[model samples]
Target: MYLYPLLIVIAASSYGIVSTIIKLAMQSGFSVSQAVTSQFFFGFCIAICIFIFTNRTKLSFNGVKTLIFAGVFTGLTNIFYGLSLNYLPASLAVVLLFQFTWIGMLISCITKRKFPSRIELISLIILVAGTIPAAGLIHVDLSQLPFQGWLWGLAAALCYSLFLFVNGRATTNMNTSNRLVMVSFFALMMAVFFQSPEVIWNGTLFSEGLWIYGLALGLFGLIIPVYLFTIAVPKVGLSMSSILGATELPIAVMVSVILLNENITSLQMGGIVIIILGMSLPTILNRNMLSITKKSTTLGTK
Candidate 1:
């Protein structure tokens, strides 16, 4: 039980650190395409290595196509997000990316043909309200923010939500490592398509220690989290997984503040707290419902 929760934390923490690392890599002269492509490439390599090392017996091809399709979203999510950072501040970009939380809930509700629960509705309200400040848009001048940046951020959120929805339904019982290899392979292919050939062949990505940054990004941003979440999500369930996943936002903000010298005001901090509260609400409600069910059963038995 604790192990599942711990895996969620590790996955979320790895994801949280990725944006800041990408920012750092950019500051060190890595282009957005270079950063995105290299990360996926390395992620594919690492996943392949792990798949071979652990599951050398035989490979299962079940649900390979669905996993590959999910990989397309995975690739797009990284591309949109990494490019969004080019025109947006890292802090605000991460907050925008966090919109996936509510978006994911909406996707679930629609797919299941059910309205959101009272707790979910309340959570969405709080999430939207908190996003204004958490994104530092409350007092900041709007004219300064690029329209393209916002578009890219929202696109990233949409694709990410779709990815989660698809991933939840795809290849549930397949070998985790093999599934990751296929997913990573397709993700890498998509990254290559979006990436300029000159950047790959011209040795541009090989300079300025970009490979090292790419290795780190691949490990944290793609490889580790996907592996852990693949294992944890089935056990803990999506609502709990999402609540735990909210750990990414604060961890991202903290990393930006500490490593990138980004600043957040008291008001923004308040908003961040609210966002965290919204994310946790669903999981808390789920737990209470379960407890009540158990209690009712016990009482009936008496």
Candidate 2:
């Protein structure tokens, strides 16, 4: 049980590091399409290798239909996300996407007919309040930021949230590794269609050490973290996993500060604290309320 939480933390941290590296890769002249497609391609290869080494018979195509559907959303999410990176700062884009938490909750309410408890409502409020600081919206000059970038970022967030929900539903009976491998296969197919074959064959794709960089990007950013996430999700449960995954936001900020020398204003630091506070609300409040209700029931019995 504890192992799942720890794995989630590791996955989140890995994602944070990858976010910064991807930004650097973009700065190194990789196009958004090239970078994203290459990552998926190599990620597919790595998944294949892992599937082969771990156990050949465990891989199954039974879930291919669901995996392909989920992969379409996943591919689109990453493509738009990469495009947003071209226009927005890594930290800003990440904060915007983290809005998925609320989106997911709302979706749950609609689909599950399960309204959030008072504690969950409080958590939602804290999450929104925390974003003001996390996004540096208080200090940043919006006039300079492109509207297109913001649109792409929001689109990416919505798509990513959908991907998460779909993937969660699809992997119900599938092994984590098997599901991941199928997801990668479908993602690779989607990427191939979107990427230019001529450029790939002409070796333009591999120029500027993309061969090496692409492999590393796939392994660290796509393969390992995703595998870890799949394994962690069932163990910790979706709500806890999502909350713990929010760690990626701060990790991204710190990675940008350290690796990219991105500036972190005092307000931005405060925002981080606010986000953390917001994330804790659901866990803390819900647990306490549950305890209180249990105690009240015992007293009523007397």
Candidate 3:
């Protein structure tokens, strides 16, 4: 029962480091277009390889169209996220992107025409509260930051939320590899249509061997998360999955600390603890629900 939620957590944790890697690529003089395109280009390459070896059920025409459409959200989210990294600090940018936690629940309520359950409401509030300090935003002066960063970051959040919503609802019965290749192919196309700069077409990637970054990005950022989420999201409903995805931010913080050797404030550590607690709410509730159901089943049989 908890397996799907655990998959979401694993996928999110792996994806959390993508921003740090993208930032490293940018600081190495790769353009956003180069980084985004290279990431998705290689992602599609991997997807195709997986699709070839994996057994896939024949898909309907409408399913193909829907997966293609869903791919756009994935592409836009990554592209805009790369753009955001250009202006904001990675921590701040991630915090902004995580605004999707609330945005996702709101989208669910609006589309389903029903309010979120009490546990979801409580988790949402806790996650938001924890998110602020986890990014160390309490120490930064937000007023000094450029408006464009906020705009792009929030836009990424919207796209990311939509991507999650779409993944949870669309053609889940299809084979995992089939959905991955279709979504990844269209996402690569979308990235290219965003108009990659000269770097993508030039020797910058091949000569300098920045293709290594693309390899890592493709494997870690796209391939792992996309494959896992495709399997997980349909099993776990949107609200629970959204909450589970909050693990990314804390995991990102830990990655920055370990890999980037960045300093973490005391407040940020506290926030990480709070975020973990917030993430645990659904799991606790689920366990209780399972126990209750088991008890009731025993009573009925008696």
Candidate 4:
């Protein structure tokens, strides 16, 4: 039981390390194509191994196809995020990526054809207001920073939300390991299609330091998080899982500051706090609502 919470923290920390690790790989002369491709390729292999070990039933082609559909968005999410980190400081880049929470809510609103609740509307307003300082746009010189980074960061957020939505709606009959293997397979395919065709043609998939970078990314970015979440979420429930997952933002920011030596302002730190508060509101609200409903039901029964 205690192990589950530890796993959650480990998963969150692993996510936090990804941006810094990518920067390190790039500093070692890795191209975006190489970095993204190797990460997904090695990740795919790891997923396949897990599936082989755990899968007992015959494979379901329908489930595999559904996961593959979701995999395209996941692939785009990673590619865009990697590009964003290349152009922006990891501190600022992570804040941009964290915008996915509100963006995902907006997507949910649009898809359901319903307006956001008052709480959600307020959260959105706070999120937008928070983004300015969080992005360091208010204090930093905007022109000096890469505009493309901002674009890619927001694009990554959109794709991340879309991936979640798609993945959630995908068939659930398949076991988790099998689903992961299928999704990883297609994510690797999309990585190759979108970024590294030339590298594939050049037959340089095994370049120096490729596996080292790939192993770090695969283990941290995909394997660890997925495996830990599978174990932790059912035990802790979504609310606690999400609150614990919030650790990712602070860890990512601190890692960047420590390893990359990026300077962040006080105003930006305040904005990050505000954004996290806004992002967490929905989960906290849901948990409270559930508690109130349970109490009311118990009283009625009495």
Candidate with best TM-score: 3
Pairs with steric clashes in candidate 3: none
lDDT of 1: 0.79
Query: Could you say which candidate leads in lDDT?
Result: 3
TM-score winner between candidates 1 and 4: 1
Per-residue lDDT of 180-294 in model 1, one digit per residue for the tens?
Answer: 8877888889987887435656776676577887888899988988888777876765545655676678778777889888887888799889878876777677778989999
Q: Write model 3 residue lDDT over 1-302, tens digit each, in one string.
A: 77888899999998898988887787788777788888887898998888878754554345776787678988989988988988999999999889888998899899989999998899889999999889988856789889999999999999988888888865836788888888888898888788473555787767987787888888877888889988898888777888999999999999989878899989999999999999999789878999999999999999
lDDT of 2 by residue, 1-302 (tens): 35777787787667666667777777787776777777787888888888878765666778577788767776776777777888987767887677766776666577677786676677667767767676566766768988888988888777766665665564555677787788787777777887533445678667656666567768766776678866776565555556666766877787788978888888878878877787666666666888999999999999
Q: Is candidate 3 or candidate 4 better by TM-score?
A: 3
Estimate candidate 2's alpha-carbon lDDT, on a 0 to 1 scale: 0.72
Q: Which ten contiguous residues of candidate 4 have the minimum total lDDT?
A: 236-245
Error of model 3, residue 267, in angstroms: 1.3
Reference-based TM-score, model 3: 0.94
lDDT of each: 0.79, 0.72, 0.86, 0.72
Residue 11 lDDT (model 3)? 92
